[model samples]
Target chain A: MTALIAFDWGTSSLRAARLDERGQVLEERSSTDGILQVPAGGFPAVFERITQGWPLHGATCLASGMVGSRQGWREAPYCPCPAGAAELADHVLWLDDVPGGARVGLVPGLSAREAGVPDVMRGEEVQVFGALQRLDTDHGLFVLPGTHSKWVRVAGGRITGFSTFMTGEVYAALRQHTILARTMAEGAQDNTAFLRGVQHALRAGSLLHGAFSARALSLFGELTEAAGGSYLSGLVIGEELRAQRLQNSALQPVLIGSPALTRRYALALSVLGVQARELGAEATWQGLWSLAQTLDTTA
Target chain B: MTALIAFDWGTSSLRAARLDERGQVLEERSSTDGILQVPAGGFPAVFERITQGWPLHGATCLASGMVGSRQGWREAPYCPCPAGAAELADHVLWLDDVPGGARVGLVPGLSAREAGVPDVMRGEEVQVFGALQRLDTDHGLFVLPGTHSKWVRVAGGRITGFSTFMTGEVYAALRQHTILARTMAEGAQDNTAFLRGVQHALRAGSLLHGAFSARALSLFGELTEAAGGSYLSGLVIGEELRAQRLQNSALQPVLIGSPALTRRYALALSVLGVQARELGAEATWQGLWSLAQTLDTTA
Candidate 1:
């Protein structure tokens, strides 16, 4: 039974999920060849290559993330919030004649504007909505960690507001490009050091003071290259956690991402005396299907 | 006669000044060949190239900044603070034999230990002491801007403590390397946009959120590339200033650096209702000479 094809394409990678009406991932294919790497032959050709024999014949194709960005296949306009699957389905853009007159729909990105200066997320909105569907709960703090980690607030199955933290991006930039790189050992992951980093977040100070400590600890022989790097990671993640707590102390942020990344966030949260639960991959798959269902009804 | 040979050799550049007993700059030369660029031929050869025919024979040579860092000419250990030129003079590293038996001295940098993690600065201590000597004041905040800007506490002619902000480095990284780079117009340094950034810093939020505004503003047609770049610069500088205020709102930090930078910092300070003054180049020369005077007296 062919329902639709979904994707979670982004800046660094691309992925496709074949799904049925029950919102289950029938089969999945992915590659590092993201929007950034797609050739001059364009996105349709790439999509066709990956979706070969996946029942594109009259299949409803849907895309999310940067694939809907200006740099991607087609510029799917961002739908400003307060929005959920209904608003998302209402604003999706579709591609015509995508190799077989197949209709390719793009889930619009969501923008938060209540505080004035606008902050936005493209694919994460789907993830948030998916969490809403999976948890069968209305209100929760969804933290989707990545290069740009998001802290989103949801109420009545719609996103009220959210904030983006440049933790992962800062980590990558500092690790590879800054003077602190001298003190870090590549490919080293130390959990104790990581916990120490989470603990350091309890101290009152700016990120600047905390970051320099990576080298200070290494110079003092108190932290090794691996541990120092881990501590640096903790400092960044810790800051993100602290910012959200400062904003709303009562809200417990629910983690949603891969097992590896979200585990670190969960560990950091536990260290801060906050219990965070992880959502499985099924959430996004479910979210995409829900939106597709909305598309079916709305269309 | 050449009373002293002074060099401010830091990470990115090397500068030389021949000073008389009165601390007047008789001759000056500089190059981009900082410690990081110096080859296996080493600091001595590079030093000789920059200081050729400058009465190296039996001259009292002195160096400060990263030249004395672990990767510099020779590692000069840092002097823990609550001390000034006198304490700095007491721990100078000396070179006995060179092209001539010139007694070359390396001024020790200062380290702050009150904050559990040790923070250090190599060259700015001289500038701080120099500001003290030139201003005839004992207590004030000294700001030296660079890739890592330093804010030092000076009281009773002693450098009590200081903190380093990675404002400039973060700006460079974001403008050149991050996703925000695409939204920014290269070679754009608008004062208006810069001020808007400084003003935005007053609003409550973390740096991650603040930085993303540069892109959001761009995406929404609210910010131009040039203005966006300046705004990014402002955000970084603004965060540093805000952190200091958060720590203690009463101190008026004195600015030291190139006129262009101090001027911008001054503008931002004024926007925030704080007045800051600039220290002239003579202050650093006077500071290096002042420390050398202490060395002479101690010797």
Candidate 2:
């Protein structure tokens, strides 16, 4: 059986998994030297250091995330969406410099434009594609919530387009640094407050007004500090729903992420009169592996 | 000439101005020990250090800002709206230890509740009130643009109510820390790009949507790095105007602040069909002085 390696090189962490030909994980290693942690031109050396004792006599490797960003070793051109596993594999950048005659391939991210809004998704596209492959549906919306939450549109087993909202980052900043920081009680979630905030945003009829209202409401004692984060999340997600509905009324949206993240999206969607499904987290790794399989076959 | 001392003890800066009975400047001193900089119970020492050699034996002293906050020397209770100079002066807190020394007074901020919305203004209350005293207007909106922009509604020479928007702080954070930091050129106004962004925000109808649109617009060449700051300024100011208009129908707003800050607010207000006038920078100091005058006469 042929052994393959897949790496997700993010901003702060490097996660690599070794898989057999059928994609069963054989070994996995994680390191702290993400792209931001390494010096220029140190990626090759770092990769070698991590995989020192791995059985790489003739292994093929696939990589994603900041490893393919502009600052990465080689600029991997982004594939325009409606992209699938085949398209991602076709655009992979093959590196032949690894020891033991191993070949490394970097998967390209996806970008798209809709209604004059340009969007780019890296690392998550493969997982989204993998989730879709398992969904048995031809068309749906995919929600990938994180520091920058992305709402993706998929049709015919391909990513048609997507939009991004800075929900996660905004929550972090407001909760950790702003005046709201003091008010929020630690490790508490108030669903009622969140739902109230979501409904309030919908009634406000404008996201801008609603965003400021979050601060006002908190100050006015209409919202508790512990629930301020949830309120903000609801407000952003509600605004996204308002904008997305204005763009496409027929597309059904699916959420792909951790349970908590997807639950928030699902809650927001339900409040907006839409149904959503939560895809598994493993979908991303599976999608990356599937792309690796395609790259191996094409090569 | 009888000396009057005015102190604006805000969160980040402590500014004290010595003036004659007629409000002519005598001498001024500033200290780095703002409310945030000083430890609890350190306010008295910090104040004494900054005002050394200034004749405080019988001068009527007025103070505003965080000096009235809970963390300040003592909690000066908030005065309800429809409050005048005499009302603010009457609510002032006198330091018990300095009873026979300086005729010390802390100006009471204005607070109001209407339609379940509670709004409060502290230091800027005196500034806007003083500006109104200068304008001799019985009714109008006063916009104080700063780290926390305040929109105060005055009727019959009393501060009826006000709304606070954290526009300046948000702008600083986004420009200095976020991904947009790379897109924003340092220091200088791009009027054209700012105008376009304000117009876009006005049309977008929501702050959250408008904020995310900045990223997309940058990608689409609708905005540039040098103009990113201006664009962001436009979006925030535009959204503020949109929210303000929803609560009040009058389109004319008086602006109180430095010339540059007011100009930006005026430009954004212009997009929303509001005529804005700069009430001048000296208004804050003058307003604090006005409160001092009232306290002196009453004492």
**Candidate 1 Cα deviation (angstroms), residue A122:** 0.8
All candidates' TM-scores? 0.94, 0.81
Q: Give the per-residue lDDT of model 2 (tens digit) for A71-164.
A: 6767787888877677888888888887667788888877776555466767888778678667766567777888777777777767787767
Residue A193 alpha-carbon offset, candidate 1, angstroms: 1.8
Highest-DockQ candidate: 1
**A73: Cα error in model 2, Å:** 3.5
Separate DockQ for every predicted complex: 0.60, 0.25
**Tens-digit lDDT string for candidate 1 (B1-299):** 78989988888898899998798899999999899999754877887789888888889888888888788888899999888878998889998756656778998888887446677888899888888888889889899987888889888889888887777887787777778988987755688888878767656345766777887778888988767878888888887777776333466778999998998898888877787889765566778889888887887
Interface Cα root-mean-square deviation for all models = 1.3, 3.5
Question: Per-prediction fnat values?
Answer: 0.50, 0.26
Question: Model 2 reaches what TM-score against the true structure?
Answer: 0.81
Error (Å) of candidate 1 at residue B138 is 0.9
The TM-score of the first chain in every model comes to 0.95, 0.88
lDDT of each residue in B68-104, candidate 2, tens digit only: 8776777787888778887887888877565337766
